[model samples]
Target chain A: MIEIKHLKKSFGSHHVLRDVNLKIEDGKITSILGGSGSGKSTLIKCMMRLLDSDGGEILVNGKDITKVTNPFRLAAVRRHFGYLFQEGALFDSMTVGENVAFGLSYLTDIPKEKYPAVIKEKLAMVGLKEEVAKLNPSELSGGMRKRVSLARVLAISPKCILYDEPTTGLDPIMSDIISDLILEMKKKIGITSVVITHDMHSAFKISDYIAFLYEGEIMLYGTPEEFRKTDNPYVRQFVDGSSHGPIQMKLMRE
Target chain B: MFTAIGKVMMNWLDQTGGAADMVRSAGFWLARSRFEFKQFVLQSITIGVDSFGVTALTSLFTGMVLALQAGNTINNIFGDPIFVGTIVSFSLIRELGPVLTGVVVAGRAGAAVTAHIGTMAVTEQLDALYTLGTNPTQYLVIPRMGAFLLTMPVLTVFSNIFGVIGGYLVAVYALGVPGEVYLSDITTFMGAKDFMHGFIKAFIFAFMIATVCCYKGVSTRGGAEGVGKSTTGAVVTCIVLILVLDYFLTAILAAFGI
Candidate 1:
């Protein structure tokens, strides 16, 4: 379980996260839903320590992770959290299998002889063929790259997985496939998962608990059913995807 | 005015803190690089093999030109053609060989390293490595440094041999100097110290070029345009520093009688 208490982060004069507090239960899928510039991604990044929080306490399994000072200990903390970047962030020079094996090689005590078998199993789990493992990221299609990235995340067997806009560039079918994979991984691996996305369908489909982030605060937090039933104007406006509503798009149009 | 000055001082201190963090990260990477022996060897071979043809060709031409120009001057004054061999061998081994190899490596290998690493950095692959419990500096910078350090002296030796042969062809075959006299003069003129000087220079030049290239590459920002700029900057800085350091090294060696 992870606990975030009184988290505050600011950049220049803009407060990206403001007095935010939340708890992520073990073996549960929590989705943070918000439009762009609503600080969903920033909140996730801060939790991962990819971005520093101005003030906060992030406790993982009853330990304050923010106080980790040693390099090895910090690395251990990072190893517990697997992040699937928005862009797939695959190493172009490495093949799919090599990319998957990268984190495992560093973080685990697995024997060298067993590495290939482990890589094969992980790739197979993500529905990637053995032949595709040898091909570089450039040769793979966008959907294939995302699958490879997912395979890498799973290979580490992380305690928690953070997905940042996982289905952003995919077609609807591909998006559904990714969403299904997310659900399957959650059920099978039984890891605490936090997915930050603006896609309502993805959020609604995958999350056991939903947090609606608006202007750097959790405006509504509950089960998907509770979120749907909320009478808050902001929540209603976002759920309906209204063009003119309480939740406005900050667009600059002449 | 005092308050404004105080703010500026505070900003400078903040910038210094960031720089300290970058240095600390670099130190951590340097330690990690020690374990990646295979990567260092492979990268070294790749860098050396790719620059071989160009370094050899440039050394050959430089030797030919040196023989042609200096041969006329030595013959006009001393009337001994054997001196042409001595002059070419000494100059090639002492200065031209290592310096030319450094320049060629900078243009070929250094720019490539910068561009490749810069692209990885900009695309967030470096960040991915960090998040994956891998040290980017150790994984990236150390192999590059190791490869350059191991291959440079060997490349310098090759450059010297090829350059001497280039001069030999110009003198014995083209200008009618006897082969025996040319060989004997080269053996007599080329001392162990001259060879050692070139090797030392090669090592220093390689270290500087690799460090500067890797630094520029990993530090790059913006995007594709930024990578291009870093590549160009790496090559230019490497060349300038090599020349400057070569002069200082030569002077210091002379003072120490080494």
Candidate 2:
């Protein structure tokens, strides 16, 4: 389980995360749903230790990563996470196969000779063909890039995977395929996941628990049914995508 | 006015402090990652061998121009161009070869490193590497730094040889000086220490360019615009520093009686 308590982050005069708190259970998907500028992505980045929180306790399996100073120890803590970026973020200089093989070659004790087999296996898991391995990331389409990014993350075999807007830009069909793959990851591998997305349908389909992030805080936290039943103006505004609700359009413009 | 000055000061301090931290981390990782021999070799070839054309061209022109002007001036006064080879070899081996080569690298390779690293930073590939338990300073910066340090001197040597050849062509054929006189004068006036002087300067310039460019690159923010800014910023900063450092290095070498 991961516990984020009193997490606060600010940029100059703008406070991005304000007294935010969350509890993410293991072996299931917990989706943090929020509109743009709602700090959902910031919350996950802070949890991943990519951005430092001005004030917070981020406990990963009971150890506070914020306080860890040693490079080796901090890296060891970070190794537990596999973060998939919003834009796939594959290394542009390397080919598709080399991208997935990078972590395997660098981080693991796996033999150098077995890297090709391992790369092939991970790409196949992401439904990527072996022929695409030779092509550069720039040559791939958006959906294929995301799948290759997923393959790269899975190469590390991290304890938990963090997805940031996994289905943001894809078509409905492609999004559903990604959602199915995410669900398969949870059901088949039984690994923990924290998905950050604003897509209500995808969140409802894949998440065991959904947390609504608003103004840098969790406005509501519960199962899908509980979320649907909530009449809170903030929650309603987001769930229904209503412009008439309490969430002003200007503030959500960020 | 005070606020603007304070902001500038703070920005300078912040960047300087960040550079120091990267240097520290790079030192630590470089010691542990001696096994990245393959990466070092690849980067060396890219930074040095692939950069042959531009550096060679710059050195060639500078040498040719130097010989041409010197030959004309000496011929006007003495009715014969004399000491053209001595002047070309001395000036090149002492200053132009290393300095011009350093400037070319700062403009070309330094910007490339910043663009490469800055794009990775903006794209969150750096975060991906971190999440995989790989220190980017070790995986990225160390190999590049190692390559630059290993190859800058070699590039300097290539510049020196090409520069002399260019000067020889100008002095003998273009200026109508005897080929034997020009060749013998180069052997006569230039010392081993003169070549070594520029060679040592190449190493220092390489270290500075690598550190400055990589620091700016890794600390890049914003996005595509930020990477463009970093590439420009790195090249400008590296060139200015290379020039300033050239003066200091010359002074120090002179003081050492080299």
Label model 1 with its docking quality class.
medium
Q: What would the DockQ be for model 2?
A: 0.73
Best-fitting candidate, scored by lDDT = 2
lDDT of 1 by residue, B74-132 (tens): 77777855477888888888898999999999999899999999999898788788778
* lDDT (0 to 1) per candidate: 0.85, 0.87
Residues A87-193, candidate 1: write the lDDT tens digits: 88899988888898988778888888888898899888878888888899999877888889988988889999999889998998889888888998988888889
Question: Model 2 chain B — which ten-residue stretch has the worst lDDT?
Answer: B30-39
Candidate 2 Cα outliers beyond 4 Å, as residue runs: A249-254, B1-9
Which residue pairs in candidate 1 have backbone atoms (N, alpha carbon, C) closer than 3 angstroms, thus clashing?
Answer: none
TM-score of each: 0.89, 0.96
Which ranges of candidate 1 are over 4 A from the true structure?
A: A8-15, A246-254, B1-34, B79-82
